[model samples]
Target: MIFSLPVQQEPKKYAPVRTLMLYLTEECNLRCTYCFVKKEPKYMSRETALRTLDWVLQRNVSGGEYKVLVNFFGGEPFLAVDLMQEVVDYGRLERPNLYKTFKFSATTNGTLANERVERVVREGQLALMVSMDGGAQANRLRPMVSGRESYSLVRKNLPRLAEWARLCTARVTFTPDNLELLKNVRDVLNVAPVGVALCPVVEADWAGHEQALEDAYAELGEWFAAEVRAGRRPPLEVTWELLRDYQQRLICKRRPQKACPLGESLMAVDSQGNVLPCHRFLHRPQQRLGTVEASELPDERWLYAHLKRAEIPDCETCVARTVCGGGCRAVALDGGYGLNEVHPYHCLLMQAHMRLVARLYAELRHDLNFWSGLAQVPTDTLNQELYQLGS
Candidate 1:
């Protein structure tokens, strides 16, 4: 079976800044080995938290932005729950018009989740993302402050966390050491139906592990294909991303111009009120566009010139460029490569993933009934939509 590629449309104008990532504190309960940020004792003060919220709200209101996604980030955001609640309450009371415009999210190690945190999440005020790398053995890299295994502690809270939050996601970081644990990803998926995002460990030497990584992804791809054939929807980030790209290409005939929202529609603010392009650039001083006190809007022209996918020479000719969005810019920068050049390991992993997903899609398309049942949308309606798109 052969799949025809859709004609690419002209790139659209850059979207306005709508995402604000507030790194609540540098304090954390876990000592993850691959942690990018150098953990510190500094925490965001209430005054600074309020100022950050006000700055984001002012931008949305003045820029005529429809919605603002406020992501609470940290070494662990739950450590500063008081500050988070104050900001949420202020948004509700002081900025009533923008109250509904605000959407809250957080990423945590799931160590400090309690009744208070549950209440906030249950109230539909926040969506929490828990970091759990596969099973116990794989999670050894993310130990507690006392250097104890944290998998059980995190696993114990999954049920309660799932019940409390309106939305919850699990993030799994696949390092060279944990490559074998890719098969155990289902263990995390079972805990949270929302899905598990598989991220490769950056800034490490992945030179000889190309074949191993490819084999692991192939196995994972086979598992995903089997689950889909069984009429069960399994939450796997890799599979979902490929499926989304397939739909966008075949149905919408359009591709994204940028890989990430950083420096474009997203910005991250540190504890001291210093603004950077994204959370990944927290410690990198040179990447700091400006501080919240100095500038309300990011320098889009500079950001576009520096971070746009089109600026990447290699991506211009790569077949998978549109789908991979030229990979992560932060990872490229960390690997001592230009923002336009993707890390070799990432490039290999993406190529393997695309091959596997393409094979699975081809097999599914051969069976008309199975393909029709895969998505919630009716077959006739989907066909009509695709027809309109290709017109």
Candidate 2:
């Protein structure tokens, strides 16, 4: 059925909101061959740490509703366990109310995760995003510092990891070699993670539309659907929802106007109090907005510039231009390195995302009345509708 715009336009719902990733340390212990973060031992100084937190808390002055997310990342975030504990512990004590709501999470290789780390995770209630490509071959690609493949190591530590996280996930990397094993890998590692997040692998070597990826997508979709159908409400975050909105704009010939939310709800404070666009945008020299050390949280004017900047030239004429915001900035930087055109994977993943999102959108539109309120609806769908009004 055609989704005609209703008589009174539904107010823009979810604007692609931002989540801040606080990089506590850049040093990493694992030698994942596919590591997206450029590894260096640069650690956050204590002073830098305090100031970064200070900036996050200041937004209370703005007096707005925001989802405050602090993502601890590192060569291994747990490597700086002492610093990690200190900041969160001190922040809670010092500033009782930092944002509207506070949420914490981390993505790690799980090599440094220990019982103490586990305790902090439980106490602080962190969302755990762990990395595993597949089984042995994936481990070969994402090996650890002690000459260990992460698959076995992460699997061994997972029981404790699962218990620590309110939610847990194995952040699998999908390269062509292991792309076909998407479901096989999940079955092999079979731990009760909060949910398995299916991410399209992007790198300089990512070949386009392999039969393996297609097969994997079909299998992965079925596997994920089966779990939900079986009443396992594990939360798997897929970009396909984002892709569908991207497609609707294309199909309906609507221009999207919502801006990239890098500096608004989200802020990335690198180990040195260096505020950046976000985690994915951190590594690149050009992308660094400013060091949190040099300035307080960015003023609205500066943030507006960063948020609205046409960093990627290709987005100029695209229908999904606004909400997608040319996809993630650092991703465009990394994958688009040379001629630096938009990552071809954007199109591929958008194809898949749009496919999934369209199907879901169809289902949701069928049950439209049942879904209401911005907070009540899923984020991906909200952003789609909002983009149309260029919110």
Candidate 3:
């Protein structure tokens, strides 16, 4: 009932392969306040997109895996759904003989879900995540380029988005200004059957708001635990991710590596075909790894230099090091901290989240009724892990 597998003598190692995010276009409908993308008129040419897909497909990145995850990223990806369709069609056609499968996903602002985008989502089985901040926060922080509220458009589109992709989720970027995390999550869940992923706005300076942020997450944790006890699987991503990581750590008896594997196992190609560590480093020319034209990926030693928590002097001694994994490199640097450093607030948040999850796991472990109720609950990985734990 605790939902953890008994420690195995020969623990199963979980090693994920590389993820390729195609920055489809630099153009977006809404100009989000915390957005990092330097909006421009640039769009990835069809040739460039297909060629970049070809480059990634041809290489066996670090070998081992036969599947590659191709994600459509953007200023807003749905604007370029036509190009997305082309790339997915090309990958499907060419990948069969190459012994590879392409798993597709996209992160959009949710304002542009038309029939074209729906077709690609259905045909390609693309998992879609709509960026929505819920209620007034959505309009205030993510207003359209024309300065109009975007909340109505995005809210209206959520049902259609959920219908198109079973794995549709709303990604809420939580900032200190909008501290009501649980309320926003509830608002989003009310609109659609999609999951809610509360991504903290780490780019903003959160020095004085540590306690507020921690309390917000704790409130969310309490509600999430209640949802579990009541036999409903809460569609909350942050808590789910924490449980998954904790479960892995228990099963494997291994500490996690860096939290953000940007330049390591994950890489992003912009509309201009220039490769970078991730979408967060989009317009910064200095962060460019190389172009798609190059046969080999640029060396990532410089990234690992600051990306690894073990190498960071402060993180080495920090209690949350293994769990936080040096936090997000982009977030650290964007918040005016050094590379390989985590914001002080982030450090506290991680500790609080882990404690919250540990308590939830302990509480549910002894609840026989809760364990039986799990039979009818739909979860992302609960059933799979439960089966593995039982075996």
Q: Could you say which candidate leads in TM-score?
A: 1
Mind sharing the TM-score for model 3? 0.84
- Mind giving the per-residue lDDT tens digits that candidate 3 earns over 140-196? 888999999998998899899889884777877777788785544777888988777
TM-score of each predicted structure versus truth: 0.85, 0.75, 0.84
TM-score of 1: 0.85
lDDT of 1 by residue, 236-311 (tens): 6456556657756877756676666667567888999887788887887777776766534465456667765633
lDDT tens string, model 2, 320-357?
45345444445656765432244656655545544544
lDDT of 1 at 159: 73
List where candidate 3 sits over 4 angstroms from the true fold. 1-17, 95-97, 247-253, 298-307, 310-322, 368-391
- Candidate 2 runs further than 4 Å off: 1-18, 94-101, 225-235, 239-260, 295-303, 306-325, 336-341, 356-391
- What lDDT would candidate 3 get against the real structure? 0.70
Candidate 1 Cα outliers beyond 4 Å, as residue runs: 1-15, 94-100, 250-255, 295-301, 310-319, 366-391
Q: lDDT: which is higher, 2 or 3?
A: 3
Local distance difference test, each candidate: 0.68, 0.57, 0.70
